[model samples]
Target: MALVAVVIPTYNESENIGGILNALSSLAGSAGLNIHVLVVDDNSVDGTVEIVEDFGRRTGFVSILRRPGKLGLGSAYVDGFRWCLRNLGDFAVAVEMDADGSHDPAQLPRLVEPILKGEVDVVIGSRYVKGGAWRGGRLSRRIISRGANLLVRLTVGLRVRDATSGYRAISKKVLEQAFSGERSYETGYIFQVETLYQYYLLGARILEVPISFYERAGGKSKLGPGELVSFAAWCFRQLAGRISGRVI
Candidate 1:
């Protein structure tokens, strides 16, 4: 059976994991696809593993990876990608989504469609697209979002809409090509843009599906003010490296 693994990296998402798993399970059953849900928990002290394990037992399609600690989002995804590739082999499609339901599980099928049909290498659940929106947060967030997107575009020279969007569908081949070895990628939100750019450099076709970007129902966001600053700094460094043709 063909498999698509949605790798959800959780820090302390006890309240949301159950619902997220259920949504994925329902989506899988409806589509008749062998959907594997991999939850890469960053050693949440709030019994996140137990919750995931219980769901895994009930669903039989869920898997849990207990990481050391609160590693950054990018590293969590990298580790999840490796785990999926190693276990699922060519049957895996690497998908990244927030555990807090910010990215609707209903939209998953749309993201996976192009890859399932062998038409694209990666599919991004884009918020900056025509049909997407930000549900909450302040006015400054919009400015920050635009600024980050602009920085990424100027730096990477790619025309992707949602630079920092976590919701993405990636074919195994594309994952292997983009993350073959440490490709100068940092472990943060900017990692999404970096990965997208890496795919672009490797000549992979990326499709962006419009998504309704919602706020997390339970937990607080990890991408706080400080992380955004660091993300901007990383973008400038990456920009310089890309322009100078340095090893990035």
Candidate 2:
């Protein structure tokens, strides 16, 4: 059977980690998915590491990569993807998910199903797509999220509806191509957009699966003003490169 590695980046997500793990564990059995949950923790001061460790002990499928200090989200996924490449020789798909419960673990099957069927090289759990909705968030946040995505769509010219969504399942071939050559430029949330853009450049087939995005159930959101600024700056740089007719 082919294996799927779910890469979850964490920092101070103790409250939601265990429950998400348990939920994924339950779904794996029912869906008959040979899934492994890889939590890439950025040395959270909170007990996030402890919770993952305990869960790993009880559930052999859960493993973790503990970093020395807090790292950006893009690097966290890059590290996790490299680990999967080295260790999971049978890996067929790699998934990106949040530990904050904003992404529904139950919808994982929907995210990976198309990839398993060889329908697409990437599957994005999108909120802006048809049938997708952003369920709960402040009006300002919603506007910012929508605006950022629109900006990426216009600048990068990516056909993806949700270019910034972290919830996605990437085929092994696409993952290898995206990570093998030059390293990613952005290390923050903008990495999400960078990855999608890279996949597009590689001519990989992409699909968007509608999903209702929920507010984080517990703990604090890691996104801040700095990351937002970084994302905007990266987008502008990409736009400049595009206008200059240079490959980004």
Best by TM-score: 2
Model 2 whole-model lDDT (C-alpha atoms): 0.90
Top-lDDT candidate index? 2
Which regions of candidate 1 fall more than 4 Å away from where they truly are?
Answer: 180-184
lDDT of each: 0.85, 0.90
Q: What tens-digit string does per-residue lDDT give for candidate 2 at 36-123?
A: 9999999899899999999899889999999998879999999999889888878999999999888998899999999999989999
* TM-score attained by model 1: 0.93
Clashing pairs in 1: none
**Per-prediction TM-score, please?**
0.93, 0.97
Q: Which stretches of candidate 2 lie over 4 Å from their true place?
A: none
lDDT of 1 by residue, 1-248 (tens): 57898999999988788888888889888987789888999989877799999988886889998989888988888888888877877565778999987888988988988998999999999888898888886777678778888888887677888878889999989888776576656788778887887788788899988998877788767878878888888778877887789846
Q: In candidate 1, residue 159 scores what lDDT?
A: 85
